[model samples]
Target chain A: MTEEHDHSGNPPQPDEDRLAATEFEILERALRELLIEKGVFTADDIRIAVEAMDRKDPANGSKVVAHAWVDDAYRARLLDDSKAAIEELGIDVGPAPNLVVLENTATLQHVVVCTLCSCYPRTLLGMPPSWYKSREYRGRVVVEPRAVLREFGTELADDVEIKVVDSTADMRYLVLPARPDGTDGLSEAELADLVTRDSLIGVTQPNAPSGG
Target chain B: MSDQEVAPAFTAGQHVQVKTGDPPGHIRTPTFLRGKSGVIEQLHGVYRNPEDLAFGGQGFPKMPLYLVRFSQTEVWDNYDGSPKDSVLADIYQHWLEPGAE
Candidate 1:
């Protein structure tokens, strides 16, 4: 990487060293004006929704794992009807009767993408991160899933099966990560520590040793 | 959204090739799946056109969207499945036609 390597051929540096986060009020005011002009979702509604989501606390994908451990029926239900099974935990997602869940273990892995459109389970998870919505990720995930996961910091063994589940009608899937090996009798909070958002997305395993 | 309508006779299991490079700006349908074959796995009730939504669409039961499934091999002739994988996508009925292949 060098100055001559700059694509635009202007030395590879910011034009000025004044990059700064804009005031939150400016953003809020702009959004408020847009919402008013749109006349559908008002800024007040947006404020309330954001506040409600913040007050709702973090997700409980880990609790679902704990239930799956102690209760056979729940595990079966999670596999059979993931939406209803998860809705029991109060996570309501979808356009109804069209939700699905896929469990990811060492042998069987599942990753999700919306090939046609960005149909996501917003009710369960909050707004999707920017990376998931990028064109580079959407184009490559299906064609080269393992490579995409590797970019996300997950490397798969040669024998692991990578199944990239797409969001579609009558079915949408979320990854139920395999329970950790040494966590057989851990408390729910302790177990929650092992379930990262990466695991939920099926990029990494629960027991993989992180750090060199 | 306006109360206008567009209709197509796209049924389940039939291949509908998405017209590639037709849309400008950001689009949900990927360029790879364009001109590809997929199975029509589901028919959703009603959805307003996303194009309209991007420009402030509001309140409608107008357009129809279908949930289609495509295999990795279908999209790409040689997928190792190191990682046996398949992809599903929600396509507007118009993006499809009767398969000749």
Candidate 2:
């Protein structure tokens, strides 16, 4: 949705027409060809990397959270060294930004937003949702966190403290939402199904599984 | 920015103020945080300078990044949240200076 365009009353181009190779696309093709010619990287390598990126999704983060909830040892490791902890589960965040996990407790809540740009834990959560990248969210979350959270239907008690984290540097954050009650008997995979992308982002808490 | 791994000048629990300036080109420091004071929550380790990396540089001299915490009331004059509410920002070393205790 972020684009540069002239506001001179020109009708918006159709999707098909716009997809038909614009100047930037042509330039990109030329540049890729040049890079391949210079032996910087191979076309096959690019293809594999793109495919791998596409495979990343919030389910990866859910698995980590689920394990943390059931295993106290893993929970401590996750908070102390998140990158290495995730690697133990075969999730590689190579070339992605460093990651940190923030724990949410009964008296504390954690929320994350990148006010400068939509910098997220892409390797864990995949592509960020449109709402996370909107100007409206970036501009207001830091100044009015409670109101913004209310809009997300997350009303917290006044006694609970809210902590809004602005991820602006070389690191990305994940909120380790408190484990929902009655989930102690569930297996790791079953618990993962209860976690959602919103909970990891701290906008909402994970829903309790049915028949728990 | 050199590629040297310099040690961080500040430490956790130290009060610091975000340096005020409008440097152009590929900056991560948000405008609203400039000149604001906060306490360092943790040292998040030395990493590549995003400002330099954005302009195609090697992102060297890897500066220390800190998690700084500011109270809701300190950041906004009319904050509607509970007094326990606080905001944390990940800021690079160069953007911060010592603050009054």
Candidate 3:
């Protein structure tokens, strides 16, 4: 064999280029550092509680809608203490006591938007969508809600009361849109499809069943 | 609930706006909510002012703040709001007054 194993005299070892974290990671690190420095929160505390953020499932919102569709009393209770109502079904609305849930019936249309930032009811609906965080959605939703709803494929009539809520302030909200007509006996999971995040936030009315 | 307080700058049901030098983005105090009026509900104290902290400062607990409520119509004239409609927002002591004209 030829002297292929020879390394001359000095050889350059691999530099081991590790992948860099994204902006999210950097910000997370910075915030974590600051939280520790300021003693506002500890890194371990965040690590332990971060599971709550992940435990959120969109199905939670659907469950509420489905139950409301079936039982009227349950619906009233939900409208009252939404946190308790959510918990009754094993879905948490979180300890953010300031959380408020608003429902949209056929006579009214309620749209939720965080004008200040992307503060949604993360406890029940999981994370927010990309469009929700966009400047266009934030500015337009608060200022010109009707137009924004139209862009989201929902056109409100002159009669339908349009309540554009600024989830920006202390009160955060989730819209319990009225269930589509004739979905009478659909199972919870089956009804969940009709309750998209958009529909729950009043951007889109619930999809009506094929036959009804 | 319990914090130092400065003299009241504006009476209840007065209009005011935010005048902080914080960065241009979705701040806690919204531009639209600012300068709008309904009524002053309570005087919430200030432990840490956002403007002082956002730019990296110890922010020696400035003069506390107050919570103000505003009707959608008052904030936006074209707002087709109902009689029983209103939203309350937290504005610092400096961000309030009688008028913003």
TM-score of each: 0.65, 0.89, 0.65
lDDT by residue (tens digit), candidate 3, A116-200: 7888878788888889999989877766676777787787776676666665444567788987878877877778777777888
Best model per lDDT: 2
Instruction: Evaluate model 3 with DockQ and give the value.
Output: 0.19
Docking class of 1: acceptable
lDDT of 2 by residue, B11-96 (tens): 99999999999989888887878888999999988988889888899888888999999888888889888998998988899999
Worst 10 residues of 2 chain A by lDDT: A1-10
Model 1: per-residue Cα lDDT over A39-116, one tens digit each? 978778888978755543225565676677567888899887777788786665534445566777767777887665
- Best model number under TM-score: 2
Clashes of 3: 1
Q: After superposition, which runs of candidate 2 have C-alpha atoms over 4 Å from their true positions?
A: A1-13, A16-29, A37-44, B1-3
Interface RMSD, every prediction, one decimal place: 3.9, 0.9, 4.4
Return the DockQ of model 1: 0.37
How would the docking of model 3 be graded? incorrect
Task: Report the Cα lDDT for candidate 3.
Answer: 0.69
Q: Model 2's CAPRI class?
A: high
